[model samples]
Target: MTTGTHSTTAAGVARPGGPGPLADRTVSRVGYGAMQLERVREGRAAAVALVRRAVELGVDHIDTAQFYGDSLSNEVLREALRPEDGVVVVSKVGATPDPGGPRPMRSAQRPEELRASVEDNLKSLGVDCVPVVNLRRMDTGPGLRPEGDQVVALDDQLAVMTAMRDEGKIGAIGLSSVSAEVLRRALPAGIACVQNSYSLVAREDEEILALCAEQGVAWVPYFPLGSAFPGFPKVTDEPAVLAAAQSLGLSPSQVGLAWLLHHSPNVLLIPGTADAGHLEANVAAGAVAFDDATLAALDAVPSRSQDVPLG
Candidate 1:
């Protein structure tokens, strides 16, 4: 059951995160992330059902990558959605699955490799053109790093990405895990959105977030509730956060996610989960409104840099 009692009408009033822009489409600010679908223990059918349930709950933006679960995420999306559903399907490149390697993924950052990855996503998702494709640059990482020839130039990668957009293989281009300078350079390519690690506590990417805001690009944060990584602090663990949650009659996670929404108007969330109940709570986070005192308390929770990678 969802913890939020807020409801939405046909106009999308009071809906999760309300509606925001992504590329050429206006989508629910509280969108779904399909990466965790790869680990659903309930089988593919259950995964499909969860996606459908999200759609039913007013989710229209979905963030995914071809490297996730070796394209299993795309396959599940293919089975669960149709183009007419009007959902904006977003994907990323710059890496591919490497099941037997030390890491579950390896760099495929070359221009040609990115093109191939886009083609693979097209085939797997059964779509002629993906709405948005984020070029996940390995500049600074809490994840895989590019090596040798795999370290491709941003302009070189953008050339092919722009070409694909011109060819209609991708509707728009986005960037992920990038620095402010890179985003500034790529702005000429017409960036539509950015996916970076940010949260109430993890604020190392504030410069990048500010740049995106200035450029009118959507800020889709990946780890909105911090991460499971050792050095990363969970937002729920903060005493102030716990106190706020209790006062509001909501969970700590809801308060954490709501803070992002309140922090920035352009911020969009792609909080992922396989459990049906958890999905409801995440969506309900959209309804979370804060008083000035609560907001001040959360704002004073002390920002820290998440130095460790989220992988």
Candidate 2:
């Protein structure tokens, strides 16, 4: 399945996207997002089984955060996987459980705080060092600009990750929910990947995705199904996307994910599902292919980024 830096199908066909540049290893472009593990009604054992199935289906990237389910995601991953499973585990820092909300995320941006967050992830995941760690910008949500005083320079946060890398606590660094301008400034500091909320109907990060491709940074897009935004139209509801799916005899989710893989060679998918059946369906999306007509139809779907802002 693997040859040098590329992962191929059993028939020797090339995958939709090539090997990720960050880990520099053979990896499937379609990856598993671990945030929904805690929401599964069957509880921890079922969550662990879903993770195992993802790997069995050839998933080579798993994205999680310490704050996801108050560290439940990483804990479940610890029970299900070992480093030898040959997958990259990516976690993020800069947000912690908010004391005010029923259960919301808050900023935790100091260097010491970031360092502690990294150690917390290490402890939870039971890994000597995570394959990749992303520094999420928490001062502002994904769609809005930050207040003048709230801005935290990328270099300041990079210093924390750089120190951790020097000490052998992390193998690579990444950025999440940041603007293209910020990514341009941060590239000199060394970024292996960039995580952002992008989907068939949400394209605000479009420029950032192109920049990542140009710079050889992996672009990991979360919420590819458009379900993360509770108020907006789901990808399945888009007329063009729905039509394409009907024509191909595929689910709307599969059509949406296949479009992302066709959108860019650097784009990496992290679609998440709590149910085992949904997990397998998400992985099967990797096989859906699009012709030029389908690609154009998907591209015309309106951008829904304004409907739901990510923070």
Candidate 3:
């Protein structure tokens, strides 16, 4: 497999900009997912600039959620792209949180409310239709309910999403924050993508990743760079990865992402960063190619150095 190929988009990234399953959608296989754009102590100014620069540097896909800051992220996204065109904007619903203060979360799928819920997302995004509507599946929780009743006992949130696909409110469907069992619940629906916690430190998803590859479904692995995992194996500290990086003259993070690009063509990397330098470094990783010897060494590295669970 080859690596280190990013297309230039003077206007913005267009789907199918490269090759493989992502080619049909204009969303680059190595596209940037925008969940990390949320403001911490700083406001949206820096994040907004980073996103705009991502477009300038040719990242075709930008994934987001209505629940991120109660649609405030979408608003910031809208403001940032006041100039570019032809970018694929993917967003999700299922959890809506308070944007102001005293943060609280709520689900908007009550069967009766499913239709309205999608409409709110369209309005919030300022787009007629979302390129993708990932059903934020939370099949486990207290006081948390699904849209339908006793009809489908398992993963009721999925039932509502399947109905909406038939109703035509969603274009292409996806799933997020799902378990292997919960993900299996969505398999019959022909979902376009699945975002789960998986990285060098979280190898529990290796099975799921292989399954997605066999099914020809896009696997958008989130937190691939050890997102706060207990005893997270520092990608920089990994002996083999460090040696490979030294050989290739790249950063450890870049080498980690390059390994992910090597994981499978179905794997779409969405490593997030608030800093511009970090963003460029992440993008450069897509260009780093590993030789057969380096790949074999990397393959020998255990998927999870620690038995830590995915976050």
Candidate 4:
């Protein structure tokens, strides 16, 4: 489920005491996900332009996937990027490519198969080894996996990734679309980041986010405005958020993003946008500052819980 609630940062987010991996990483706390850059021919140029613009604007992190167009997105990534400073490329593997596009297909963890995925992304993105490698598990399917099959054994995925890392094929290890228990079990093996659905309305990742904060791991919450979910609550349209946006003369989107930036230093938002104007607006949300009263007011909303939370 998704909750489209929106609000702004409450005062200044806890800044990095000094320099840290999560803080010093290339992408901004509010970074871009390159999935939106795919679709048609015209989209390619716009995506390239957006990547170039994002770098120029000090946005460092770029997330993509091998399943995205079977390497089309990777090609655009390399085309838009330069041998510059503070740029960390993060990509995921697991889903197979389809003729129409990348779909929720299946997961296979053979070492040779992973190698093929890597070769494709590396050649397309033109990178030796991407900074972050996200292992996308296949837990979403018809009839869903039984308890025994639902859980992906750590040793299995770790074996493949550990080999790849040792062979200098990946930098940091991360996971997407996983439960808190699964994440906890996988942490000891070197989980640098975790991507889960989290928001004011969707508290599925709430505990996971706090754990990441405690463990000093970066927590990347996708769909900040709640787009991935079907029945997610509308945070942006909430009475409190609407009132606050009206008070600030800001759009509902800006207020929503601002709330995440203010949520916690451990929270890293990767909102996807292809519209040029919307991209700039989304990035600008990273700079918003929410006051104490405003934070309270937004938090006061009686947000509904997610229908099927992994928390």
Q: After superposition, how far is residue 93 of candidate 4 from its true place, in Å?
A: 1.3
Across 1-311, the per-residue lDDT of candidate 2 in tens digits comes to: 22553665332444434455555555678888999898889888999999988877777688999989888999999999856677789999887766477546666766777898999999999989988899987422343333444366778889989999999898899998787788898898789998887788888888888999989899988767774545766788899988998999989888888888888888888888898888777777777778888888888998865433455
RMSD of each: 3.4, 3.1, 4.6, 6.8
What is candidate 1's lDDT per residue for 193-220, written digit by digit as tens? Answer: 9998889988888888888888889999
Residue-pair clashes per candidate: 1, 0, 5, 21
Once fitted onto the true fold, the runs of candidate 3 whose alpha carbons sit more than 4 angstroms away are 1-24, 40-45, 82-84, 98-117, 138-155, 229-231, 305-311
TM-score of each: 0.94, 0.90, 0.80, 0.83
All candidates' lDDT scores?
0.87, 0.79, 0.67, 0.67
Q: Across residues 1-311, which tens digit of lDDT does each residue of candidate 3 receive? A: 12333344436343222433542463555667676677433677877788888776667677887776667768777877753455677777766665564445565544454556677778877877677777665543112344454223334656677777777667778877666776776788767888776666456767777877887778887767765544566566788888988888888788787787787878887777767888778777766778899999887877653333222
lDDT for model 4: 0.67
Q: Model 2 Cα displacement at 100 (Å)?
A: 6.1
Clash-forming residue pairs, model 1: 142-309
Which of the two, 2 or 4, has more TM-score? 2
